[model samples]
Target: MSVLNGISVSVGPVLFKAACPDCRSRFELAAGALRLAIGGSRRTTFYSFTCPECGSAVRKPAGERIVELLTGGGVRTLRLHSTV
Candidate 1:
């Protein structure tokens, strides 16, 4: 876990499915270690994925903004920040 800015980031393994925008291909993405970049240094955590047909990533990481990572999609940065 990493604290970035004022947010507590949690990095953990995740298994998800991704749909290709171009090919409309549906695949699975599994992460060994979820990465969370925090602070000014942007320290990151690591994760891994294993899938026979999944050879590529569904989406990229989030930018300097706070975003929600969807199952198949990438991170979604919202206009407002909230913690549940």
Candidate 2:
């Protein structure tokens, strides 16, 4: 792992490795690559990402521990407000 001209090359476990389900391309992404949304309901709390290789939108449910790790790791986050 090396940083070339400010670009990181997976120096450590700090960066997450994701696999695109559509294209099957594996790549390393920083916490910035993920987005977390916390909502009024437990079912609404989750994380989202776009697969760089296939351009497919991917969303996964985030549990309590996941939310903690993601937030601690610097992942961008949004809070959802219910109109009802």
Candidate 3:
């Protein structure tokens, strides 16, 4: 395992396996790339992404899918879809 910057490397067959924090359901993900959607009335920031497997309603109202990316000096995360 290679370490990029201070965070672990995220490449090759990246698998994001986690239980839905809301539903407590296990999820296995295999996405080609991380997705992001910018939104907000006053402040702009990184929001949650979406789930390809489960429908939009599963994580709606706000973002759901977020992936960890390693950069030159640090790590940046991008959301796949936003519920809101």
Candidate 4:
């Protein structure tokens, strides 16, 4: 079990509903299948998932709300630092 935002969630193999825009195929994916990145700029911050049906990579913008949900859902997240 895991606690997210103070809410207890079952930590076992949980499936999340995902859709492939390219092939229009809908499927379920585990938390490990998704990746989230928090970047310094809006354009750099996004979430990624692979489409099992078409093998296409999908990336979507991760706004504040999306970030919260993704993190709470146990998706592995990475912090991006700008080296300048």
**Who wins the TM-score comparison?**
4
lDDT of all predictions: 0.40, 0.85, 0.40, 0.90
**lDDT winner:** 4
Locate the minimum summed-lDDT window of 10 residues in model 2: 10-19
Model 4 misplacement above 4 A: 1-13
Residue 70 lDDT (model 1) = 36
Q: Compose the digit string of candidate 2's lDDT tens values, residues 1-84.
A: 788999987655567667777888989878988999998778999988899888999888889988898898889899999887
Tell me the tens digit of each residue's lDDT in model 1 across 1-84: 879999999976555654555466666654322233232222331122322454544333443432234322342222322343
Q: What are the TM-scores, per candidate, against the unseen true structure?
A: 0.27, 0.73, 0.31, 0.78
Error of 4 at 12 (Å): 5.4
**Stretch of 10 with least lDDT, candidate 3:** 66-75
Off by over 4 Å in 2: 1-13
Model 2 has an lDDT value of: 0.85
Model 4 C-alpha lDDT versus the unseen true structure: 0.90
Candidate 3, residue 61: Cα displacement in angstroms equals: 13
Worst 10 residues of 1 by lDDT: 39-48
The regions of model 3 sitting more than 4 angstroms off are 1-12, 37-43, 47-54, 57-84
Superior by lDDT: candidate 1 or candidate 4: 4
